[model samples]
Every structure is written in C-alpha cells, then in structure tokens.
Target: MGIDDITKKAQEFLGDDKVKDALKSEQAEGVSDKLLDGVADAANKVTGGKFADQIDGARDAADKSVGNE
Candidate 1:
C-alpha cells in the first residue's frame, strides 16, 4: 500500500484502547512520543513541508501504534 493507505490502516489498529493504554504506560510513553516527534520533524525537514500532510498521517499512525491518541 501507499504511505497514506498504510498510515490509515495503522491508525485503525492503533485505535484499540488496550493497545493505547499499554503504549501510554510511563515506561514506554516517553520514548514513543519522542520517537514520533523526531520522525515527524525529520520528514518535515527532508521534504521542506511538501509532505506535511503525509508526515502528519504518519504521526497519527505512530500515535495509534502506541495508543497515545
């Protein structure tokens, strides 16, 4: 799938509350947050914000993956 499609699917899976809760645990939440932010920042820098929407989608994917949002 394309990046946007991949991100959409990933976000759906990350919507599970149990998974979300587990991801937000004190032990892992900090790392996950930092990782997502770093990845988003890197993408934005690399594309000069041309793909800001895609980067945001990826961020949503990460957030859902870690059950953060």
Candidate 2:
C-alpha cells in the first residue's frame, strides 16, 4: 500500500470507539500527556524554541483528540 493508504487506514482505526476508549484511558493516567510533553520539548529544542507556542498548541490539540479535556 501507499503512504496515503496507510494514513487512511490509521485514521479509520483511530476513529473506532474502542480505540478512542483506550486512548482516553491512557490520557486519564497521564501517559499521553507525558508523551506529548516529551515530543513538544524535543520539537522546541530542534527549532531553538522559536516554534514553542505552536508546538504546545499542537500538543494540547492532540491530547484533546484522545477524548479528554
């Protein structure tokens, strides 16, 4: 399959209720937040903190997508 095909499949899987529920559980325990924080920190370091705000916003959006506030 192509990159688009893999992306589409991933989107479909993430859209499933079961998958969402699992993500929610992970978020509840702070797992996703920690992971996102690490990612954002790395991204900020890569760009010398120039895009920190945008990276943080993306991190928050990703966290919310998992089903939490």
Candidate 3:
C-alpha cells in the first residue's frame, strides 16, 4: 500500500469507537499529555530555555503521533 493508504487506515483506527473508549478508559491522552509536558519543561530548564519553542512543536508532534491531538 501507498503512504496515502496507510495514512487513511491510521486515521480510521484513531476514529474507531472501541479504540476511543479504550484510550479514554485508560486515560492515555491525559497521562501522555502530563508526561510530555513534564519532559518538555525539564528539557527547557536543562537547556537554559534555548529550545522551549522547538520543544513545544516536538511535543505537539508527539501527541499527534499517538492520536492525542
């Protein structure tokens, strides 16, 4: 299959009711968000605030990758 086909399939999975319910039940989104936020914050502090903006973008991309965005 092509990239488009894979993308479509992934979208379908992300939208599935069963999958959605499972994710909600497990609090996957909330947990992941909190965890990512903490990591980003720590990284920013470690870097002396040099990559705060870039870290936000990376965090958003990570969330989207896991169907949280």
Candidate 4:
C-alpha cells in the first residue's frame, strides 16, 4: 500500500486521538533521528522488509500530519 493508505490504516487502527497524542508527546519530548530509525527498523521487521519504502513514506506522512515537518 501507499503512504496514504498506510496512514489511513494506522489512524483507523490507533484512532485519531491516540495518534495525535503520540505525535504531540513525541514533539514535546523532541523526537530523535534515532527514534525515526527505530520506527523504520520496526516497520521493516514487521513487514519482513518487503515494503520498506512504503513504510518510510508512511512515517514521513505521519510526521507531517502531526506538524513535525
């Protein structure tokens, strides 16, 4: 799936409020590049590295949505 699709799925799974809270908390705490790397790593592991690009794009879109970018 594409980034938008992944984002939509995540939102659906996690709920908007939870997602917003996570984003806000992360932003307030100052997310590190290493954290993003960890996210990528987790995504890669979850998908067996088959959809790495899509996961990266989704992560970027999620960050943008949360006003981090």
Top of the candidates by lDDT: 2
Query: Which digits, one per residue and each the tens of the lDDT, describe model 1 over residues 7-52?
Result: 9988987798776677778757678778888989998999999999
**What TM-score would each prediction reach against the true structure?**
0.58, 0.76, 0.59, 0.44
Assess the local accuracy of residue 64 in candidate 2 as a C-alpha lDDT between 0 and 100. 83
TM-score ranking, high to low:
2, 3, 1, 4
Cα-based lDDT for every prediction: 0.80, 0.84, 0.82, 0.72
Best by TM-score: 2
Across 1-69, the per-residue lDDT of candidate 2 in tens digits comes to 999999999999989988878877845538777788899999999999999889999998888866455
Instruction: Name the regions of candidate 4 deviating beyond 4 angstroms.
Output: 1-29, 32-36
Worst 10 residues of 3 by lDDT: 60-69
lDDT of 2: 0.84
Write down the TM-score for model 1: 0.58
Clashes of each: 1, 0, 0, 0
Q: Which stretches of candidate 3 lie over 4 Å from their true place?
A: 1-26
The CA-based lDDT of model 1 is what? 0.80
**What TM-score does model 2 achieve against the real structure?**
0.76
**Candidate 4 clashing pairs?**
none
